[model samples]
Target: MTLANGGDNIGIYTPSFAIRSAHEIIVIAVVFVVMTALWCFVAHAIVNHPKLGSPIRRCGHRVTPFVLVGLGVLILYQAGSFGLLLGRSGF
Candidate 1:
């Protein structure tokens, strides 16, 4: 997921920059790696802590599936609309 987001950020933001060079790309990659590592460590610590972990875990279990289902439904709706549009256009 982080990789996908990084790729998307690169795709969406890189073109507007004045200089698109190896140095810039390397810097972006390094920053992305560091930030991802930092966040992973933070999340790990939070999830493993004795005080807060249990409630967070329980909430995650309850909420994650519904969030995923919502995303799935949204994707399906968009795809269905696109398909309908294409068909109407005789594509």
Candidate 2:
């Protein structure tokens, strides 16, 4: 996104920066969704299955509550973002 025209005098940003920002937002969303789904699957596997008796499964069972809370935090973050976009506190 190099919009600098030889650095003679003018200062202007490139148009592609906006597109880059949009791409970053989409990537972040996809990453969050994938991570949340993974966490839930691991949590459910540890909680409900009798065959998954490994140390990692024990850890996942213990960590499932916090994973759920982390999901709540993620949702709160999205709510705050929507509030910022609307220029008001989310009711």
Best by lDDT: 1
User: Each model's C-alpha lDDT?
Assistant: 0.65, 0.56
lDDT of 1 by residue, 1-91 (tens): 7446576444434443333578877887788799989988998999999999999888988887797667655544443543555675221
Can you write out model 2's per-residue Cα lDDT over 1-91, one digit (the tens) per residue? 1134445212111221233577776786688689978988986777566766576655756886797567555554554644655787652
Q: What's the true lDDT of residue 76 in model 1?
A: 43
Measured on C-alpha atoms, candidate 2 has an lDDT of 0.56
Q: What residue pairs clash in candidate 2, if any at all?
A: none
- Runs of candidate 1 exceeding 4 Å displacement: 4-23, 61-91
Candidate 1 backbone collisions, by pair? none
